[model samples]
Target chain A: MNPNRQKVLDATLQLLAQSGLSGAGLNDVIALSGASRGSLYHFFPDGKQQWVAEALQIYAEAFAEGCENAISKAPTVSQGIANVFLFAAKMMKARDFRSGCPVGAVVLDLDCDSEPMRVLCLSIMAQWQHRLAAHLTPLPEAKALALAKMIIACFEGAFMLARLERSTAPLTLAAEQMATLLEAQLATVSRSH
Target chain B: MNPNRQKVLDATLQLLAQSGLSGAGLNDVIALSGASRGSLYHFFPDGKQQWVAEALQIYAEAFAEGCENAISKAPTVSQGIANVFLFAAKMMKARDFRSGCPVGAVVLDLDCDSEPMRVLCLSIMAQWQHRLAAHLTPLPEAKALALAKMIIACFEGAFMLARLERSTAPLTLAAEQMATLLEAQLATVSRSH
Candidate 1:
């Protein structure tokens, strides 16, 4: 990727996380990325929509890859999920609760008029779910998919609460509950097998 | 309340849920509510911030009251939580999945520059958790509070996913998972007693 383009995308993603779509205006991107007006237009000719879409796609891919790596390294599904949650909590606390999942930001502030943007966000979300479910190979496909949905929902919800309260207690509590639920499912799977 | 004032407040809350703070501009409010600009100013003399805050406060109170009624009528904590989730899912579907929890919208689109707005949102969120926890008298106070937090997190998370996917599956799945967790905790309490 071109350095300037990469910088612009990074700035857009951060702004989206910290503030949402409205907050990631062209001016804000230029200010944060230090990319000149001419260059920014050169890289993203379609303007704000183009850049926000590209930035979110990049974020969704990286986020899914990191979550997959976390899941693959843990011995059990529960521990793997816990690792992901704990890492998210750490990042939230470090950012002073100013940031949350960028996909979530898009979903919350989604404009009903933009069909293409909405479809792109839906695909990004589906990709995240599919990637996470792939790591739960020991479970049946349907069960794994359900659990993945639950985990995603819990993570998004907990992150929002944690951010609002300026405390990670919500995220930590969510992690423990998810771990316990996954453990119970794993035990049932073992007994049935 | 006066009918015109009530109309404006309702319109503001819906716009907030469908869009965000930025989307709920004065023109949008006037267009949606059918209220004169003069009347809007008459009712909310302090402008956008005042009306948004007022609308959200009204929503929080109604939401808490409805949730409390759901919990009080249920046979157990798990069922009560399920009722809340199911009702939310129903509303989301009825609205064509365009709207979601107003507080979640505020949290996601929260402007880092505004301290009072952030604080107001936090109090609304805290009020929700407190109201939900108040009905779980069968359990110890600490445990009930923790469960309430989890329920809130799951609801917010699931609602966002469901809206993105254009389906209620995520909300239903979250309800089931929350019910299972609460039932397991209730079982432990019974055993200890």
Candidate 2:
């Protein structure tokens, strides 16, 4: 991405994180990025929709990278799941709870009508699920897939609740609960094997 | 609630559930309720903010009632917890993924500085936690409280993920996982006692 374009998308992400899709405006993005209107037009001539779509894509990549890192680097899948939750919690807190998963917020805003945006959101979620499933491949595929989906749901839901409640307890509890759930699943798999 | 006022709030809730707070305009509410502009103003003189607050309150009450019914009617605390998830899943599917918990959508659109809205959102969540805890009183108080928070978090998070992914699988999986988690906790409590 061009530095100027990247700057525009990054600013839009911050604005979207704070104000949501409808809350964010082109003027705000221009102001936040300190980029010229000409530059914004040069990059996204189609305007807000285009800018937002690109920003969502950027966030999707970053989020997927985080999941990849967690699974690849953590000593255990349970620890990796915990790390992912911690990372999300920290990001949300750092953004003062204004930032949630872009995929989640966008999906809520854009329905099937916006085919491109819908595809972007679904692709991100599917990729995240795939990554999580990969980590759980040692277990039964069905159980692992189900568990991965549940874990993702818990994390997403916790982010919204924790953000809405303006407290970290929900996220913290979710992490602890998830760790326990994953541990039990691992135990069951071990015993069966 | 006056019949007209109830009509207005119910319409607002329907609109909010379908399109979110920003997406639901006063005109939309009027159209949905089939109420004249004068009547809408007569009911909600302050326009969207006042209307949204009342709509949110109505949603909160209905949500609490749902929780209460689930808990009180179920055979056991574990079953109660599962009932809550099952009910939520049904509601989500019924809405075709358009409606999530009302508080979740409101909190997303509310300005963080809007103290009244923030309080209302917090109160609803606290009420949910309280209801869940009440059901689990037979267990250890701390454990009950912790589990309550975790369950609420999971439900809210699961709703978001399910809606975003436009799939009921996440919701179903989350409910099953939560039942497993709750059953395990209950067993531990039983063992300890």
Top-TM-score candidate index: 1
Tens digits of per-residue lDDT, candidate 1, A1-193, equal 9999999999999999999988899899999999999999999999999999999999988888888888888887789889999989999989988898887987889868878888999888788888888877778999999999999999999988888888988999998989998888778888998
lDDT of 1 by residue, B40-93 (tens): 999899999899999999998999999888888888878988988998999999
Q: Write the per-residue lDDT of candidate 2 for residues B1-193, one digit (tens) a residue.
A: 6788889888888877766777568888888888889999998899888998888888888888978888788887777777777878788788787667666766666555677877888888888888778887668888788888888878876777777766787778887888889888888877887
* Model 2 residue pairs with clashes: A157-B157
lDDT, residue A144, model 2: 85
DockQ of each: 0.85, 0.59
- The runs of at least 3 residues in candidate 1 whose Cα sits more than 4 Å from the true structure, single-residue gaps closed, are none
- On the 0 to 100 scale, the lDDT of residue A164 in model 2 is 77
Query: Model 2, A62-181: lDDT tens per residue?
Result: 877878898689898888888888877887778777666655666565533676766767777778787788889778888888888888878877877777777777788888889988
lDDT of 2: 0.78
Residue B65 CA error for candidate 1 (Å)?
Answer: 0.8
Q: What is the C-alpha RMSD of each candidate to the true structure, in Å?
A: 1.2, 1.9
Global lDDT of each candidate: 0.89, 0.78
